[model samples]
Target: MRRTARRAGKALGAGAAAALLALATPAGTAQAADGVLSIDGTEHEDPSGCFPLGDFAPPKIANLTDGTAWIWSGPSCDGQVTQQIDPGTSAIGRGRSLYIE
Candidate 1:
């Protein structure tokens, strides 16, 4: 009975650790910025994931949200990253996509 109790305690500890790690790790689209991402002066509120910028890629961008924004050269944010705009920051770079994280 004592050994069984010990095993149960170990399992509980491990499970707790796993749960903590999961909480600490970033879940896809789970958390989002509480602000907006401005593209060419247009604000996109509560943006999540990748925002594609088709042929008319905006040259000026402003990250007014509390998240990091990545400017990608290719559509769907698959290619090179043109700029990294942080929270409350702005940049002058043209890109085909914008990823807010």
Candidate 2:
């Protein structure tokens, strides 16, 4: 019984250490949310890219580029296009697709 208790204690200690490490590190592998689109809770570093809206159901958050960006209401850069997304301008609505050049 004593040996079993000692093993359980060591396991608990290791688990606590791992939990602390995870909390200290960043959550995702994306760049900072400064100048990129945060699609489906993931930030894309590049200013230009095609992200399928279908991949992120109920698309939540997004961040505009430094210069300018265009947002589309449909996937594949289709549908209504909202122009002039300036710096520090966060895309409030859930755009079906985002195109920045």
Candidate 3:
């Protein structure tokens, strides 16, 4: 009975430690995209958050990531949404910025 109790306690402790480790580690959910976002001919891998074009509005934009994003007519992801680019797709427009989710 004592040995069984000790084994159970050890198993419980291990489980607790594993849980703690899992909590401490960063989750993959924080990543916005899992693939690439091509702007013009340039490629951005594992893109997340807002991407400002900054003076250059490319005519061709591609979203090869596993996520969707919006092409904005202005910078900072605030303003008119020119287009919504989905995964494995592309758009032909003059966009000043891009926002991903």
Task: Give me the candidate number with maximum TM-score.
Answer: 1
How accurate locally, in lDDT, is each candidate?
0.84, 0.65, 0.83
Supply the TM-score for candidate 1. 0.64
Clashes within 3 Å, all models in order:
0, 0, 0
Q: Distance (Å) between predicted and true CA of 33, model 2?
A: 13
- Winner on TM-score between 1 and 2 is 1
TM for every model, in the order presented, reads 0.64, 0.47, 0.62
Off by over 4 Å in 1: 1-29
How much lDDT does candidate 3 score?
0.83
Off by over 4 Å in 3: 1-29, 54-57
- Model 1: number of clashes? 0
lDDT of 3 by residue, 1-101 (tens): 99999999999999999999999997766666988888777888898888877675465878889999888888888889988888999887567888886
Candidate 2, poorest ten consecutive residues by summed lDDT: 30-39
lDDT per residue, candidate 1, 1-101, as tens digits? 99999999999999999999999987664678889888887788987788876676466878889899988989888789988898998887577988886
Best by lDDT: 1
Candidate 3 clashes between residue pairs 3 or more apart in a chain or in different chains: none
- Candidate 2 lDDT over residue span 1-101, tens digit each: 99999999999999999999989998766333246666567877755655565634546545555645566778888888854356666544456676665
